[model samples]
Target: MPDARGSSGRPRRGDRKLSGDRAGAALKVLQITDLHLRDDARPLIGVNTEATLIEVLDQAFASFTPDVVLATGDIAHDATLPTYLRFLQIIEQYHHGPKLCVPGNHDLIGPMIAARLPIDPLRVGNWVFVGLDSHVDDEVGSQVSDRDIAELVAACPPIGEKRHTLVATHHPPLEVNCPWLDKDRIQNASDLLESLARQTTVKGLVFGHAHQAVEGQSNGIGLFGTPSTCFQFEPESERFAIGDEQPGYRWLHLYDDGRIDSAVERVACSFEIDLTQRD
Candidate 1:
C-alpha cells in the first residue's frame, strides 16, 4: 500500500513518487456517482446501470488512469447491505489508485454507522477530502449535520497554503435550478457555504445526486456536480423527469500550482436509447 508521500520527499497523488527532476506532477482524478444499483440485478430506466458503470470505469481507467477515484454518493438504490457490497466489489476491481466515497440518500446510513467506516474527512496529497452524510432516513430531503460541518472546517488545510481542498457529499449544497430537486437539496446549505466562505484553503466542492453535470462557483470556490453512471436528470427543466443524455463521469486534473481543470465525458457504448419512447 503506497502512501501519498513519494521517495523524493515531495507529495505525490498516491503511492507512486514523481521523478526527482520533474518540476511538478498533475493530480488526475475520476469522479463517478449515482449508481442506483439494485440487489435484484435489474436495470433502471431501460439501461443496465451496473453494466454501464462497469464499462464506464473500464473506459476511464484506459483513458485517464486517475490517481484517485471519488464516488460522490448514491451507490445503492435500496440501501441494502448486498447492494453496498456489490458496489464495493466493483470499485475494488476497476480502481488501481486510492478510492474515497461518500454515501447518498439511497444508501443505508445505519449500516455505515454500524460498520464504523470512519465518516470523517480524509487528507490526501495536497488536498483535503470531506465526506458528509446527507441522507435523512426515509425522507426525500437532505441535511448536513452540525457535527459534519465542524469536522469539515477542522479538516481544511492551513490558509495561504498551496494545497487544494474538495468537499464531497451526495446532495448539492445549492439550488440545481429544478424545483423538485432543489427542494431536496442539502438543508442548512447557507450555513455550509458561510463556513466555506471563511476558509481560504478550500479550493472546490464536488457532489452527486443531481445525475447531471453542473459547474458553478460558490464563495470563490469551484463547485461541480458529476453525472451519473446510471441515468441522467433533465437539466434546467421545470418538471421532475429523466433525460436521454448519455451516462458519463467527471475527470479532474489538478496542477501542482493550485490550478484545476475538469470536464465531463460521456461513456461510449455500442447502443443508444431513445428515452422518450413510450412503453
Candidate 2:
C-alpha cells in the first residue's frame, strides 16, 4: 500500500508536506447520502427530508468537523436546479470544506452540473477521492460506462505514488443483501472491481442508495454503504421496507498511513417514519 509520506518522511497531500501536528492528523470525511431533497418541503413517508437532513448535519457537526463533505447521491428528489441549490445552501451552513457528490437514480446530471457540485477527483491529505457517475437514464439500476472506467484508471496515482484512492458513486458495486436494492447494483460491478484491482493505490469504495448501513471487504478493499439522511430501508429484506431507524450519516477518518476508520451516527431526535407507507 502506498502511504501518504513523502521522501522527506512527512505526511503529504500531492507532493505538499503537511505542516505541524496537522501533518500527522487524520483527515476527517463526513459522508451524507440519499438526501432526496425536493423542490417543495415535502416529507418522504412521515419524515420531512430537508428537516431530517438539517438534523443529521447538526448532529454530524456537533461531534466532529470534517475536512470534506461527501454527498454520495440522490441530492435532489425533484432533480431541479432549485432543489440542488437549496441542498447546497443547507450544506454550506454546516460544512465549508470540499462538497463532493455523484448523481443517483433520482438525480439529473444537468441540474447537478448547473449547481456546480463537483464530481471530480479531489486530493485531500493522503487520499484521492474519485467520484463516478453510475446513473443510467430511465432506470433504477446503475452501471459504470467503459469511459468512466478508463477515466477512473487514469485518475489513479501511478504505482510509485504515495496517495491512496477512494471511489464514490451513487450505486453499490457490491451487494448489500437487500434483494430489491441489490437488483440496482452496478450492472458491470465485476468490471469495476477488476479495474480497481489493477490499480495498486486504490484502497476503498463508498456508495449510497442502499439507504442502510453496510460494511464489507471485496478484493482487499474496504466497502462502505451509508444510511440515508432522511429515511432508511430495512436491511437484508427480500422486498422494499422502511426501517424505524433514525436518519443518519457516516464519518471516515483517513489517516496518512493508508488506514481508514469510520462509523455511522444517527440524529438524537426521533422522526416517526411511516413504515407502512411505501413511496
Candidate 3:
C-alpha cells in the first residue's frame, strides 16, 4: 500500500565505523516478527510464512549485511518443538552474526527450556539487548513476571558511558489502540515502564505480535512494533482482519553517538489475499 521503504532516500555519511573506541559502533540491526511457522507444512493465513521468512532473509543478506538480528516473537504458529527447530535451521543458514529472540504466546516454554536457548540479557557492540518472556500459560494476553522485571532491572547499565539498551519482547508494553489486539497486549505494562523510566541507558522497546508495523514513544523512550513476515493485520481495526499492506521487516541503524534510526522494508514476494476467510 503505502511506501514500505522507511528510508528517506538521503544517506548521511558520518565519521562512524562498525569498530573502534567510539561512543558506540554503527550497527545495522534487523527486526522481524510474527512468523507463525507450523510443522504441518501448510501455509498459515493463506501465506507461506517459513518460505517468506527465508526469502526475506536472503534479500536482507544480499542488500544489507546487519550486525545483529532481533527476532521479536511469534516465531511459531503452535508451541511445537519441530516448529522451533525448523525456524532455527532457517536462521542458521542465513545469519552469521549474533541473533536474539524472545518468546511469543505461540512458543512452547517447556520445549524452549529443553532446547537450552539463551535466555540471559546480552550486550552487543554498543547496545544491550534484553530478552523477556511474556507468554502466559495457555492464555492470549501477556504479563511480565517478577523475575522478568528483575532481569530487566538488573540488565540496566549505568548512566554515562553505557551501552544503549533495547528491550525485546513478544508483547508490546504500550497500548496499540486496536480493539482485538489490545485485549491481548502485555498486562501490567505500566509497571515495566516505571522500571524503565529510571534507567538512562535504556533507549527503546521493540516488539512483535500485532502483525503490523507501528512506532511510538513512551516515557521518552522509542517504541517500535514490526509487521509479520507472512501476513499483516489491519491497523486500528475493531475486529480481526488482514490488511493489504506488504509483508516486511524493520531495519535499525544505531549511530556511534547514541542516535538510533530505523526503517521498514517490504519483502519481494507476490501473494494473493483471501479476504473472505476473515468472515
TM-scores, all candidates, are 0.83, 0.88, 0.85
lDDT of 3 by residue, 215-276 (tens): 76666677778888888888768888788777788877777555777767777677777655
Q: Report the error of model 3 at residue 104, Å.
A: 0.5
Highest lDDT among the candidates is held by which one? 2
Write the number of the candidate with greater lDDT, choosing between 2 and 3: 2
C-alpha lDDT values of all predictions: 0.72, 0.80, 0.73
**Ranking of candidates on lDDT, top first:** 2, 3, 1
Q: Whose TM-score is greatest here?
A: 2
Compare candidates 1 and 3 on lDDT and give the better one.
Answer: 3
TM-score of 3: 0.85
Off by over 4 Å in 1: 1-24, 113-120, 270-279
Badly placed stretches (over 4 Å) of model 2 are: 1-24, 275-279
Candidate 3 residue-wise lDDT at 71: 83
Candidates ranked by TM-score, best first? 2, 3, 1
Per-candidate Cα RMSD to the true structure, in Å, reads 9.3, 8.1, 6.4
Of candidate 1, the 10-residue stretch with the lowest lDDT total is 10-19
- Candidate 2 clash pair list: none
